[model samples]
Target: MKSDSTVLPDVFRICFEHYNTAKNLPTGKIKNPNEILREFDFEIKKNPADAAELFKDMQLYLKLTPNTLTPNFQNQLFSGLNQYALAGDWLTSVTNTTMATFEVSPMGTLVEKKLIEHMNRLVGWENGDGTMATGGSNANMISLLVARNKMFPEIKKEGQLNKRLIIFVSEDAHYSFEKAANILGIGLDQVKKIKTNPNGEMEPSHLEEMARVSLSEGEYPFFVAATAGTTVLGSFDPIDRIHEISKKFNLWLHVDGAWGGSVLLSSRHRHHLKGIENVDSMTWDTHKMIGTGLMSSFFLTKHNGILRSSHNHGGEDYIFHESEIAEWDSGPSSLQCGRRSDALKVWLTWRSLGDLGIEIQIDNLFTMAIKAKEMILEYKELELMYEPSSLNICFRYRSVSDVNTLNKKIRHRLLEEGNFFINIATRKKETFFRLIIVHPDLNETHLYKLFSDIIRLGNKIKEETEFCMVKT
Candidate 1:
């Protein structure tokens, strides 16, 4: 057995070693459940394990897990870790306090309040209110709940009655909206999907037409969500145009900017979210683009105190005490009672980078996106699927036949090889590679190598298929 003082230092040393060598590690190694179970000792016993045994287990865990910190990782929207944010996360764990009450977590409560204030300013809101959510999905759900409660105040206490409530979102909006609809007691079928343009942006005219039809059919259209940076093509819905329809139909307008909200940091690219201030509420995920740790999501609204009005109930007699700073308590506004302190990491990251540094990082990513598009164009075999509106670049290799199948195979091979980690998306029944350029270390050299490998793998697969057919 080792003392706590000695154990802490030894564990930290192991963590440091793993962190320093993460870049050299393979992005991931494919393994099935059976394979992993066979390889690792993941059993519990009545007896306590030795400290040395636990240390070895920790090392094994790090070795087997995918290294998202490396440049080779581009499989998801988020990649790479901010050192300051990491430090903040460590500190948050060391403190181990709940954000339920201001008294217990005074600094944390203030940090969240200040971060929301800064984000509100970016969105052009003067007297706005917000709360850190579990994730973007949670934030989006909160938006729906608040909108529903505001429009039909009776529903909160009296329950959803005979009224057939409806909500509208672009066809390309994240599926989380539908999930939110389900969770918020709004039936899934009641969620309407407005048609989008060829570029994947919401068609404002179509939105108006649908609202009119819904009104004529005696359905109450209460919410219209405009997507800022859709999931697949990364398209920004015309917020200004959509706002007109929302106002005309008396609908609560919410922008699901979970994927692209960070663009507000960049002066040159902030135009993507034009007219954002007019929206009633928004969902922003700092973890996606800002590289903060996971779950740094905010559900912000221009309407002051709406969050508390919607979510606060039955907590005053207990956790929420009567004090001057009781108004600053975050539990009353949040959906969860025992909320983890998620604000510190985002605050630390933002402070370390400052607004200018963040803006430069965003601008540089856009530049990298353009470079990726150009590089794809230069390749004779590669075909661009859609002109990228943001950081997500969709393209695929050309095959004489079964192009979609070939592209899927190439992606699988890339994953199996563990040389490059990327993703593929299917739209309109056509599958293609969806290269997310998010990691700061991702550059021209990495792009060139990825393309070369993709082309090589595509050609190899095609040749193998032809040979098999000839043999048959």
Candidate 2:
């Protein structure tokens, strides 16, 4: 709060305090929009406020926000942040450097390059190219852009040709593929959603049939996105079989491994992504499975210079100078001009926990998922929506009437209670809870408690609903 060299240290103290508090907090206290507006002063003023006032505001903000760092939190793809990752992120912020060029970010550049090299080798690529993206969605978009430009180079400048370029993705694939298509001028209609099996894995035969039909209809099939971990079901499409289909059609194979790519480190679970070496490009987010901080996403490609060729454009005459080190600059190969050093946190985290450490973390999550499934099966009131494939275990408390509505209400009540925070998703018109075994500290006790809460709350909601109906 005071002006001087000590201000930063004071802020760090507050941060550490908040971090300690967050780790121990039971699920976050959920605040509605109206309550948040009344509870905090969010308006920005033209005049500079006292440092003490601003510090108080910062504390209040942290207090009101959801505690995603806590072990009880399992609402999203990512969970607790790694300590080394936090340290690196703080260092990166204090340094305040951009990652466009090596000259500006010498250590950052080398760190990113080395991290990419290490990750590429893990994915079975000997000399692949990669770049750190803003998020997993951006990584997927970059993959799509690179694939498109490689397949149709002229489209980069000359725009769309006579043919309607088509892309294929499993029905379970992330929606980012469709968003990428729209951004690239490839119509959303051209993005065909190939049907998946009952287990949510994409069917290669269906993809082949669809590609054949598209070709017969005079459409160009250029790309196929195979998901390594689907959003709702955590299903990994059979990469070996899908690779065969991609080869037959001459389509660029992009594996969207944003959620499950960390499995590559696990010898036991790595079989989920078999034939990953054959993929033209991939998206992997260490923040999700590896517990690096938020938004540590990478877009990797087997093609050497395709990314630079696809995204590069001549600009910034003042900034672009002929120099020996210019070639090492990562600016030309990315979608953003002024990129933050997202690689530093991941690099630090990876260094803190070597490849084996990463493997153990991922392997533990997979084992926890299996344990969760077994616990669900043991409960008669709970229904396992789908077979366990990865860390994502979908299930719900069963009710005789209006099960979908009941599950939705149960989730709402769960959040309102603020003892546990989880997520729910619907498939085939059936709503169910998507319990992710993502947190490093989540265990059988937490799973047992979650199931108990769901059943207890579900019965209460059903009884209230029936009582109201009878009164009406």
Candidate 3:
């Protein structure tokens, strides 16, 4: 709490200590959450007086560190944490600055504005506008807010009537879009789900027919959210065809590329987002694909200064002080106040990697997916749900006659046994393992063993399903 420079060493020491502990800890038997939290709180409360008690030789705490940095850690979209991203985050916290106003945070505001413009250029919009959001979901919500404002300009000043102003999305789209509709005071029922193809891509014709049916039923169709990369399935709805439908009906186009947007950097995969430049707005999360630590989400638009029009709250008498060097603050144009300098992390990442590094990372992830598919096909016991569109692979083991129960038993056992951790998802009432291939270090050998372990566990647990179900 004294000189900032003097305190920095302790911060670095403590951070690295925790990092090493997490990296070295045992993978089995996740420590009890409640006990760990109680101990952690006790440590926090004794902070200045007893920092040593909280950590002794780096063996403390009750939470699983989730070794996402390790190649075996494939449960999440973001795997390895970039050193530049962490450096930016630590500096931002030490400065303890808020990004509300240019005057209060001149450098931060400028950095964010410039970053927005830089991102806009890639989307082929020279004059597009945007705001860095808290997370991908919040960014998706902002997209809905902007679209609603554009379609019903009055809603900005005069709230939404229960006119059933509907929005359309594919069945495979991220669930955050629904949360956005609910937050905007649009009932959850107002979100219409269009059917998708076997590959999980949204059917454009189905969307068109659904729009016609909505119109026939006298419901207002105002927005359509297309997914560039779905969370579980890793599917992309055709942007070009979806744009055609949006134009035919004058609907606002919002692309949720939270998980897949970073592919924009890849010259080869860029064609997958062909008509992305035509969309009204987009939600992109650098944290997911760029490995920029956590929460690097941006809500971007083609229309200049449209974000300010949609979200700028009224009467800034205190923060937006006028002066000879007056500048507009980011707060007035966002739903957040006291925003962390999230821009710093993204800026550091962009500055360090530039566009090419990001492209290589993306291309490598897709290439890894290709190798993963080959490995899955080679194993006679496993079945792939669909071809991976990005980095997630949905597949299950195909054992003898009664295999589903065996596969489910193996997955539950893997989590309990805890040599490695993976996720499972249910689609059309069928449950299957969902392997994420985001980390660059995860090669074919790791995946091969992971699949092998599942089958071994499946055979091991087939006899004790009834006993283990009620064991824990």
Candidate 4:
């Protein structure tokens, strides 16, 4: 039997081998719940498992999981992995420290602070403040909370009471905003969806009209969230135009840049967020675009001390003590008590790539997006649902009748085949494939293969359906 120390090293080696070979393998194998339950032994027994059994379990776990690093993986908003970021994540797990206090996590605290400063500068906020969130959703929720507290300070102590607070967001905005409103005591009905134009950009005129209506109806209009990149269409709301309306109504403006914030690094693409600096707050998820490890999200604001004012409460006597370094403590400004050291991975990734390297990466992705659009147009069978705006490319296979059902069947067959991993989305009652191009390894070859497979599968399914109908 191998010693415990030796076993861990061996396991690490196995994991490294798996990681290196994943790109060459199929993206994933689709397994239903019953198939998985029968294939793997998941029972936690009365006694501790032996080393050999544990090792086998680890191997099985790796084998069963989907390979997100492969170019075929265009499923979610994020794909691939940054090697430097992975190293930082490993170090964080080994150290195992919370970011609640500077005393316990000194290096972590400074790294997080410096990273926030650099990100804020990119957003054109010279002296802004921010903190790492669990994910983009959490950061967005925090934005709502901070905006609410700052606008209605009395609500913190006195509670919402009879106050009917209203929030305005584009109809194409992330669903997280609706969840945040519910979590923050703002009723779902109070979330007014502003009308969007044909291109999916928010109509500024409709926003102002709604704000006026809210005020007249005795509802307190507070926050307006503009999406930097909408989920399905990847549309960026006209931030400059929206800001004018926010100012007129004294509404807190927040840009949800979770999927598109990294565009700020690209000089050419930064125009998407033209009036970002003027916004009251913003949510950025580096993990989505930069390919950092999961959960590298930041909630940034121009107002430096608002986070402390909004979230700080209790913990003074026990964890927070009076000291020179007390100001460095992140607990006061955070919604969590035991936050993980998420900034180290992001900081390390930035340092390894530098601003110029990341800029080039973003620029290259935009170019690739254009290539994808061109390819979609080249094929007669494949139809482009919307023009390429950012990384997301929404398209579907053309069919004579029952186009929606045929496309859905094509996607389902593609997943079962396990050669590719992409996603399907519906916009305006029409279904299409939402291909997210974030992985560095993705190229023209992968895109060609994906479309070829989709077309081939679509033709086969259609022919089979026709044959069955003729036989009947």
| Tens digit of per-residue lDDT, candidate 1, span 77-154 | 888888888888899899999999988898898999999999999999999999999888888899999999999998
- 148-173 in candidate 2: lDDT tens per residue? 88888888899887879999999899
Poorest 10 consecutive residues by lDDT, candidate 3: 54-63
TM-score of 2: 0.98
Off by over 4 Å in 3: 1-11, 17-49, 56-59, 324-327, 400-404, 463-472
Q: Write the per-residue lDDT of candidate 3 for residues 1-472, one digit (tens) a residue.
A: 2344544476577677655554433344434579567655443443364345434423343344545655666677777677788888888888888888776777888888999999999998999999989898999899899888878899888888657798999998889888988888997999999999988999999999999999999999999999998888888899999999999999999999888888898999998888999999999988887888888899999998888888877545776666664446788678887898888988998899889988998898899898988888988778998788878898998765566566677777786776667878888877788888887556777788788888787756654755787796
Clash count list over all predictions: 0, 0, 0, 0
Which 10-residue window of candidate 2 scores lowest in summed lDDT? Answer: 1-10
CA lDDT, every model vs. true structure: 0.90, 0.90, 0.82, 0.91
Off by over 4 Å in 4: 1-3
Q: What digit string (tens of lDDT, one per residue) describes model 4 on residues 353-381?
A: 99998999888888889999999999999
Pull out the clashing pairs in model 2.
none
Residue 105 local lDDT, model 2: 88
Alpha-carbon RMSD to native, per candidate: 1.3, 1.4, 3.3, 1.3
The TM-score, computed over Cα atoms with residue i paired to residue i, of candidate 1 is 0.98
lDDT of 2 at 410: 92
Sorted on lDDT, best first, the list reads 4, 1, 2, 3
Q: What's the C-alpha lDDT at position 467 in model 3?
A: 73
